[model samples]
Target chain A: MKVKTKHIMNLFYIPALLLFVAFVVYPFTQGIRISFTNWNGYSQAYKYIGLDNYIRFFKDKNVLGAFVNTIIYGFGSTIVQNILGLAYALFLNSKFTGRSVVRAVIYMPVMIASLIMGYIMYFLVQYDGGAINDLLILFGKAPVDLMSQGPRAVLIMTLINILQFVGISMVIYLAGLQNIPEMYYEAASIDGVNAWGQFKYITLPLLMPAISSAVVLNLIGGLKLFDIIMALTAGGPGYSTHSLSTMVTNMYFRGQHAGYSATIGIFTFIFIMIVSNIIVRYFDKKEVEM
Target chain B: MVQNNKRAAIWRTPLAIIIVLIHFAPIYILLGMAFKSPKDVTSRWILPGYIYKQNFDIAINKGNMLAGLYNTTIITVSCIVLIIVFGALAAYPLARNRSKFNGGIKAFVLGIMMVPPLSILVPLYTVMAGLKGTSTYWGIIVILTAFQLPMSIFLYTNFISAIPTALDEAASIDGCGPFRTFFLVILPQLKPITASVVILTGINCWNDYQFSLYMLQSPKIKTITLTISSFFSQNSNNVNAAAAAALMGILPVILLFLSLQKYFIKGMVDSAIK
Candidate 1:
C-alpha cells in the first residue's frame, strides 16, 4: 500500500516531464535530425547532406574564432568574477557603514535586462562623445574606437559581464560566511592565528561549497552568453566577437543556413556538457578532500 | 588585532564609496541620456540641466512600449505561476523518493539547465511555428516556464528534502493520501522557498530575450526587450529616445529590486549556494 502511494506521488512529475519532452527534448532530437539535412529553416523540402555541415564547421575559420571566443568569454569572466566577488564578499562581510547600500548598488545591474544593459553600456563605449573617450580627450589623447577591434571588444564585453554579475557571487559567499559560526573565528584568534592565517586555514576550506556554486554558475552563464553579444556587437565587426550561441543565431537568421546552424547547435550542447561535467567533477573531488 | 581592523575599516569606507560610484555610472549615463535633448551631443558623463520630455514621448509611441508592457506583464505573471506550481509539484516526489529512477530524473532536470536556449533555437522555433504558436501569449509563456523550471525545481527539491518526513508519515496515518498529505502537510511549509522561487523565476521570465524574440515576433506581441531592440535597429541615430525606452525597461526591475531588496538578494544567494 505504501509503495503504491509512493508511485502515485511520482505521477505528479509527469506534467513537468511532458513539458520538457515537448520543448527541450523533442526540439533537441529534431535539431540533430535537421543538422543532417539541407533545410533552410522555413521550407519543408530539403535533402539529407549527412556530415557535410559538420565538416564545413570543422574547416570554417569563423567557427574556429567563435569557439575560441566562447572559451575566453567563459573561463576569462569566471576567473575574474569569482576572485573579485570573493574579495568584495570579504570586505563587505566585515560590517562597514553603508555596506547594504554598497551591495545594493553593485547588484543593481543584475536586475536590468542584459539586452538593455548592453545597449546602456554602449553609450559609454561609443566613439563620439563617449564616456571613455571623453576621459582620453581630457588628457588630449586621440579618441580610439573601442568596439571596432575584435580582441579589444571581446575583453570589454567580458569585463562588462563580470562587473554586472559579480554581486551574485559576493552574496553567495556572504551567506556561506555567515553560516560559519563566530566561535570558529574566536577560537582561531585564541590560537594566535593571524588574519591571513585564519582565512587560509579556517575560512577558505569551509567556503568550498559556495565557491563551487559561484564558479560553476558564472562559468555556465558566461558559456551561454547571447543577449549581450546581440545588443553590443550583433556578432559583428566581422564575426570576430561571436560566441557559439550568437554564431548559431547568425547562421540561422542571417546566413540562411538552418542545417548548418543546427549542427553547430549540437556541437555547443555537447561542448557545454563535457566542459561543465569536467568542472563539476573537479569540484566534487575537492569537496570530498575538504 | 580588533583595533587594527577598526582603523582598516575607516580607510575601506571611502574605497567602498568609490566602488559604489563606479558601479552606478552606467545608470547615471542612462539617466543623463534619457533626459537630454538630441541636439545636446555632449558627453554621456554630463547631466542635462533640464528635463527633455520628448524622448520619453518618442519612445512610447515609436517603440510600442505600452503594448509591450501589457504583453510582458501577462506573460511574466502566467509563467511565474506555472513555474512555481509545476516546479514545486515535480520537486516533491524527487525530494521524498530516494529511488534510482527518481535520482535519474533529478539529474536529467539538471542537465536541462546546461542546454543553451540558442543551441535549440532552430528546431524549437520551427516546432513553435508549426504549432501556430508564433506571436501568441500562451506559446511564449509555456516555453519560458519550461526553460525556467529547472532552477526552481532544484531549489524546491533541496528545500523539501530538509522538511521532516515524520510530518508526512503522521498525515498518512491520519487517513490522508499522498495528494492530500502533500496539499495539507507539505504545501504550507513551502512558503519561504516559494518566495525565493517567485523572485528568481520572476526576474528570468521578465528579462527573457531569446525565447521571446522568436516566439513573440509580432510587433503587437513584443515584450520590453524586443520593443527596445526593434527601436534601436530602426534608428541608430535615435539615441536619446532609445535611451528613454531602455530606461523604461530598467525602472520597473530596479524599483522592484529596491522594494523587495531582501528577497532579491536572498533569492540570488539561495539559488546559488544554499
Candidate 2:
C-alpha cells in the first residue's frame, strides 16, 4: 500500500518538476547568458562582452540617477505607507462603531489599478485646472505646480502611491493585531497601563512580523515601480523620476544596447535580492523569538 | 463621569469622521471632476450646474473605452481560470507528499516570487514573440497565469496542508480514484483559499500594465491599463473626458471591492503575512 502511494506521489511530482525546470530554470539561465552578450533582443549572432556592460552602467549618469531615485522612492513610500497603515489599523482595531464600513471606505483606493489612480491623480494635480489648485484658489492661496517641478513632482507621485496602497499594509497589520491574545491587553489594562504604554509594549512588539512583511513588500514594490511613474510622468521633465525598470525599458526601446539594458536588469536583480534577503533574514530571526 | 464619557465620544466621533473624509478625498475629487463641465473643471471650486454627458460620450467613443473594457475582462477571466485549475492541481501533490523534492519545490516557487518581474521581461517577451503568442489574447492570459501560478500554488498548498489526512484515506477506501477523490473531496475543501486566490489574482491581472504593454501591441487587443495610458497621450487636454474614462475603468473594481470587502481584506491579510 505504501509503495503504491509513493508511486502515485511521484506521478504528480514529475510533471510539476518538469514545468518548473522548463519555465523557470531555463529562462533564468538564459537571461543571465543573454546579459553577457551584445545581442539585440531579436538577433541570433552577437559577440561576448564580459563586464563591459556593467562598466558602462557605472559610467552612465542616467543609470546612477535612476538608482538614486529608486532608493528615494523605495524608502519614501515604504516608511510613509507603513506608518500610516499601522496607525489606521490600530485605529480601526479599537472598539469602534461601524468599523467595517470605515475599513471599506479607507481601502477603496487599493482596489483600483495604480495606473488608473495615476491618471486620475494627474487630473487632480494639474497646474491650471487641477482639483487641488481649484481648491487652493477657493482658499485665496496661489495654485501650486504639483506635477511640474522636480522635487514636488516626485513628492506628489510618492504621496499618490502611498494613498493608493496603504490599505494593503493596513490589512496585514490588522491580521497581526488579531493574532495578539486579548489577555495581554486585559492585563495591561488591569495594571493601569495607559493606551500609549500598552501600545508600545503589546502592539508594536507583537506586530513585528506584519511590519516586516509590509516593509519588504512596499520597499520592493516601490523600487520596481514603473507603471505609475510611466502613466503619471513618463520619467518626465528630464528623467528626474526615472526608476531602474523605466530606464531598462527606455534603453531597450532606444535599440542600441540591449546588452547594457540586461546588465542594468541584472544589477537591479542583485540589489533587490540583497535588500529583500536582509529583511527576510531579520524576520526569520524574529519569528523564532516571538 | 458619564457626562465626560459622552463628551469624549462626541469628540472622537467627529475626529473619526474627519479622518474618513480625508482618506476618501481622492475619490471625491475624481467624482467631482467626472461630473463637472470642462470650463467648470478648470475654474474655481464652485459646483458644476449640469451633468456632463458629452465627456462620457467622448470618452466612450474617442477613447475606445468599451473595447478596452472587453479586452481587460477577457484577459482577467482567462488568467483567473487557468491559475485556478493548474495552480490547484500542482499544489495538491506538494501538500500531500512530504519529501526532500517537495521542500525543493517549495523553495523554487518562493525564490521565483522574490525575483522582480522586470528582470525577466525581455526574455519572456522574446519567448512570447517566438511562440507567435504576441498580440493575441492567449498570449497575455498565458503569461499572467504563468506568473501568478507560483504564488497561488503556494497559498493553496498552505491551506491544503492544514486539512486532515483522514478525509483522503476515507475517499480512497470508498473506491474513489485519485482524480475523482481530488475533484470530489479535496476541491470542495478549498473554497476559502480559492476565494482568496480569485480575489487577489483577479485584481492583479486586471491592473497589470507592464506585461500587456510588451506582449500585446495591436490596438485591438489593448487592456485597460494600456488603453488608459493611450488616453493620456491622445487626450491630454480633455480633462473631463479623461476623468470620465478613468471613472469608468475603476468603477467596477471599486464596487467589487466594496461588496466583498470582508473576504478581500481577510484574503489579502492572510496570504500576505503567510
Candidate 3:
C-alpha cells in the first residue's frame, strides 16, 4: 500500500505533464522544425532551406529594429515602473485619510484589459478631435499626432503599460513594507540614524525580494508586449513599432514568411529564457548577499 | 514644529486628491466617449448634458457585445475550473515528496510560467488547426488552462508545503488511501490559497487577448477583446460606438475588481513575492 500510494501520488502530476507536452513542448519543437523550411502556412509541400532564415534574420534591418525596440520596452518599463511603484508604495504606506481609496483608484487600471486601455488612449491622443489635442487647442497650439512618430509611439505605449500595471508593483512593495517591523525604524531613530540612512540601510536591503519580484514581472510583461502595440499603432508608419511578439504575427499573416516567423519566435523564446534566468540568478545573488 | 506638521497634512490631502484624479483619467475619457452622441462635436472633455445612451445600444446591437460576453464567460469559467483542478492535483506530490525527481518537476513548472504564449503562436495554432480546436470553446479553454497551470501549480505548491505532513500521516493510518486522504483532508484545507488562485487565474483568462485573437477567428464566436478590436478596425469613423463597445467590455470586470479589492491585491502579492 505504501509503495502503491507513492506511485499514485506521482501519477497525480501526469495529467499536467501531458498538457505541457502536448501544448508547449510539442509546439515548441515543431516551431524549431518549421524554422528550417519555407512553409507559407498554407502549403503542405515546402522545401527545407537550411540556415537561409537565420542568414536573412542577421541581415534584416527590420528584425534589428524590433530587437532594439524590445529592449526599450522591456528595460524601460522595468526602471520606470519600479521607481513610480516604490514612490506610490512609500507615500501610501503612511497614515493618511482615505488611503485605501487612493490605493483602489490607482489599482483600478490594472484590472482594465490592456488592449482596451490602448484603444481608450487612442481617443485621447488622436490628431483631430482628440481629448489632449482639444486641450492644446485651447492654448492656441497645433494638434500633434502622437502615434505618427515610431520612437515616440513606442515610448507612449511603454508609458501606457507602466501606468496600467504600476499598481502591481505598488502593492507588492506595500506588502513588503508591512512585513517589516516598526521597531527597526524606531530603533534607528533613537540611535541618531537619519531618515536617508534608515531608508538606505534598513529598507533597501529588506525590500530586495519584493524588488526582485516586481522587476522580473515587469521585465517579462514588457518583453512580451503585443496587444497594446496591435491596438495602438498596429506596427505602423512601417514595421517600426513591432516588438518580437507582434513581428512574429505580422510576418506570418502579412509578410507570409512562415519560416522566418518561426525563426523569430524561436529566437524570442531562447532570448527571454536567457534574460529571465540571468535576472533571477542576479536577484538570487543579491538576496544572498543582503 | 507642530505648526509645520499641521501645514504638511493640509498639503497632503490635495496631493492625494490630484493623484486620484489623474489616475482615473482613462476611465473618465472612456465614460465621456461612451455616453455622448457621435455628432455632438464636443470635446471628449465635455460630458453629455442629457442621457444619451445610443452609443451603447449601437455597441450591443451592431458590435455583438452580448455574444462576445457570452463566449468570454464560457471560456473564462472553463479555464479557471481546469486550472484549479490540474494545478492542485499536480502540486500535491511535488510539495509532499521532497525527492530529486519531484524537485525537477517543481523547477519545470516554474520554467513553464515564463513562456509567453506568443512565442509558440505559430506551431500551437497549427496544432490547434490540426485538432480542429480553432473557433471552439473547449480548444481555447484547454489551451488557456495549459498555459496558466504552471503559475497555479507554483502558488499551490508553496501553500501546500506549509500544511502539516502529520495530517496526511494520521489520515493514512486511519485506513485512507492517497486519493481519499487528499480529497477529504487536503482539498478542504486549500480554500484560502484556492481563492488566490481563482482570482489571479480568473483575471488572466478574462483579460486574455493574444490567445483569443489567434484561436477564435470566426466573427460569430468572438471574445470580448476580439470583438472590441474588430469594432475599432472596421469602424474607424464611428469613434463613439467603439468607445461604448470598449466600455461595455470592461464594466463587469471593473465592478468585480472593486467588490473583491482585497482578494485581488492579496493575490498579486502572493503571486509575486512568493
lDDT of 2 by residue, A157-274 (tens): 8888888888889889988998999999889988999879988889888998899889988988888888788888888778788889888877776655677777787788899999
lDDT of 3 by residue, B1-274 (tens): 4596587778778889998988888889889888888888988888888767888898998888999999999999999999999999999999888889999998888888888788888899999999999999888998999999998999999999999999999999998988998899999999998999999998889999999988998887899999999888888999999999999989988999899999999999999987
Model 3 regions lying over 4 Å from their true place:
B1-7
Candidate 3: the clashing residue pairs are: none
Give the C-alpha miss distance for residue A264 in model 3, angstroms: 0.5
What does candidate 1's lDDT look like per residue over B1-274, in tens digits?
7799878978897889899999999999999999999999777889999999999999988888888888889999999999988998999999999899999999999888888888999999998998998899989998999999999899999999999999999998999998998899999999999999999988889999988887887778899899889999886897999999999988999999999999998898888875
TM-score for each prediction?
Answer: 0.98, 0.95, 0.98
How do these models rank on DockQ, best leading?
Answer: 1, 3, 2
Considering only N, C-alpha and C atoms within 3 Å, which residue pairs clash in candidate 1? none
Question: Candidate 3's error at A268, in angstroms?
Answer: 0.7
Q: Give the worst 10-residue stretch by lDDT in candidate 3 chain A.
A: A1-10
User: How many residue pairs collide in each prediction?
Assistant: 0, 0, 0
Quote the lDDT for A120 in model 1.
Answer: 93
Prediction 2 TM-score vs. true? 0.95
